[model samples]
Target: MKDKINELLERVENFRPKAVAEIEDFRVRILGRKGELTALMEEFKSVAPELKREFGQKLNELKRRAQERVAALRAEAEQAAGEASSQIADMSRPGSEEELGSRHPISLVRNQIVEVFARLGYTVADGPEIEDDWHVFSALNFPPEHPARDMQDTFFIGKNPDVLLRTHTSSIQVRTMERQQPPIRVICPGRVFRNEAISYRAHCIFHQIEGLYIDEGVSFADMKQSILYFAKEIFGEETTIRMRPSYFPFTEPSAEVDVSCNLCGGKGCNVCKGTGWLEIMGCGMVDPNVLEACGIDSKRYSGFAFGMGVERIAMLKYGVRDLRLYFENDVRFLRQFESAL
Candidate 1:
């Protein structure tokens, strides 16, 4: 026609396209539909009626310069692919190692027994894993036919049998001796419920910490040198402790405490099954009817209470012979305590 519309408007002003699939194959070779401008609009309907207005204005200026040269070669191929993806994107490196999370080996032995009794001043107290029956067993002296106030070992909570759940965090030391008083050096920790029977050494939900130290001349040799400086700050400095004469309707001449095994340094093994000793807690001296049922004048504030089992001191500090691997949240047994945090 007009020399094929000036050779497709000089091939659409030199259509240059390095990428975006060559600007969609140059917009399907100029607006496709059997394109070449739809075969020049069927050769301008058999051109001839007085050259149909100059080949209909040069075929609408060759279809508007083939749609503005395929929209300027698709914006210069998307700005050279966003500057080659921002020069291979190295936004100051350091990124993919992300997997951290560790704690719960019964909260790392209950925060290492509340940081070894918070460096001996104790503090931290808390209560209510749903209790009653006088802060869990008649202010700790427990006897109302005590088989741990049975319903096959307490969980009671519904038909009002004096509510239940707490089978011991000594009901947060009888709710911190019925609302603090007595220079009570606290420590209680938490989570305790027992209807029992889930084993690898028992559990129906567990955890307990308990400690109390009422003021004014507290003893049993100051609870045996504060549990032998808390068993040499948790089993080390060549630990040693002994106590034995046990019983516990809230401690009184009660005792149990063992420690001295740390796996064979006591010269025995099979994890202390060979009698190097390991028991680990339950102390004595607070029961004058559990300090007169929390009003504390049990012959004037004589104190000492102890307790353990933060998953039995995190299975004797991580030798962990399955207390159901601290409640089976097993990410390969919690990624082996991720380097013990």
Candidate 2:
């Protein structure tokens, strides 16, 4: 029994498990029910009383050492397994997908509009949002008594009221004509300001893209062809346009341009107010008074001018009813346009 006790004690001190499973199995063999230590405990009862004290001590020491060694070896084995797994992993593999960002819907539509006109020899023109009455109204044939000159319709900057926010990109066209001579072809795209009430269809601040073309022999026919081509290109090849006689301060024989409702296929709907048409822009032959005001010879050079609201175009193209959506900066609303190029 003494030899047995010494042998088991040496086994406990020398035991080293090659794997975590081996450590658990070793524990069961040494300390579990019906195992070596359990069997030895049963045998200890049969020993002489004087030897029982020494054997019992040795048995208890062996059991404690066995448990300690099994636990230590199991922990070491598990740590080694974890290290091996890490080393074997492929770090070069792609990680979890990261979401990509996109341009704002308004920007995307603006760029598209510019690209469309760019192909037709129209260079982009820009001007300051702030302007004097001359460039914004006077040079554009806006009479002093025009309602647009009133504070109710326009944003005045100071007590003098001459300095104000431009109500249209036509100021850019006026600036262009002042610097350049005839044969001028430019498209003005910019932000404009007004004093209108905020609503789903109207805003105090908005964007406009107005086009001007002045050269010899330019006529109303040329304007019609050009606008027709633009309507077709923007709303789809099947789109058609009609010019209803209208009025504007800067243009003679002004007409409000309407395109067949692309949404309802011209059959009439709530969007088009069941009219089977959607008002898109205004167009006319540049009023001679406007040309002379900008230093161009009204007699030698005849041209056409057209203007449209960028928000209105976007609303039609994207089917967004509320004009407020363009300005809200809501992430959820913006995320929907992520797929738009």
Candidate 3:
């Protein structure tokens, strides 16, 4: 019994495991129900009473040593595994990671809008979010008396009245017109800012996509047909549209564009406020004055301009009641869009 105890103690003190399989076998051999230490304990239990205490003590020592050896073996095995894993890991190999994102509702709508217009041969155009007055309001035909220049509507960077944050993507249209000649076909998409109280429906900042097309003899009929086609593509083939006469400072004979409410199928709903039509955009013929202001001859150049709010379109499409939700960055709300497709 003493010999066994001494043997196990030496084995435990010198214990080392080179691999996981060896550690597992060591654990079973030491701690298993039918292990050698357990058999020794059984033998000790049956020993004559005179030698019971000494033999039992030796058996317990052997059991303790065996347990310690098994623990050391396990730790050594794990250490070896870690070292080998580090050596064999392919640092140059392409990494595989989780696919954890989906397009945001706003991005989805924006891409869809771009795609629809792309099919119609309009190229995507971009400009700086921070822009100047000449391109934004001046070329777009804002009158000198227009209140938008009063510093209440625009965010100015430098003291110069020329440099300011763009309140509309109309600035991009102006830039495009100044650079590109006739047969101009471009869609400008960008961020716009306004000073407003954040509310369920309104925000101080938002996104807008504006389309401009200039060529010979572009008419209100052409504008209407283009909008109708856009409405059909966006809403559905069955969707109907109605143009409500409206006014804008830039475009002559401006009208608000609306689509038949999909939620109620034009029957009227809370979304449409019982009108059965949800206003989507505002558009009109490019004013002759605006054309002249942008260096395009009004006599030779006739075009149409249309603009829509991205968040508004997204809200109507997704039924997201609160505009604040778009900016909150709440994971719970964002995760709902995880499977956007």
Best TM-score among the predictions, by candidate number: 2
- Candidate 1 residue lDDT tens string, 190-225: 888889889898988888888889888788998899
Report every candidate's CA lDDT: 0.84, 0.91, 0.85
Which residue runs of candidate 2 sit more than 4 Å off their true CA positions?
Answer: 1-94
In model 2, the clashing pairs are: none
How does each model score on TM-score? 0.38, 0.74, 0.72
* Models, CA RMSD each: 16.6, 8.1, 9.7
Model 3 reaches what TM-score against the true structure?
0.72
lDDT of 2 by residue, 194-271 (tens): 999999999999999999999999999999998898889889999999999999999998999999999899999999
How far in Å is the alpha carbon of 333 misplaced in model 2? 1.2
Q: Would you give me the overall lDDT of model 1?
A: 0.84
> Candidate 2: what lDDT?
0.91
Q: Candidate 3 lDDT, tens digit per residue, 1-341? A: 66766776676567566656876777677667887667677767778999898887777777777777777767776787799888889888987798688777788889989889998899999999888888878888888889988787778887898888889899999999888788998999889998678899988889999999999989899888888888888888888889889988889899999999989998999999998999999999898888888789989889999999999988988888998898888878878888876
Order of quality (lDDT): 2, 3, 1
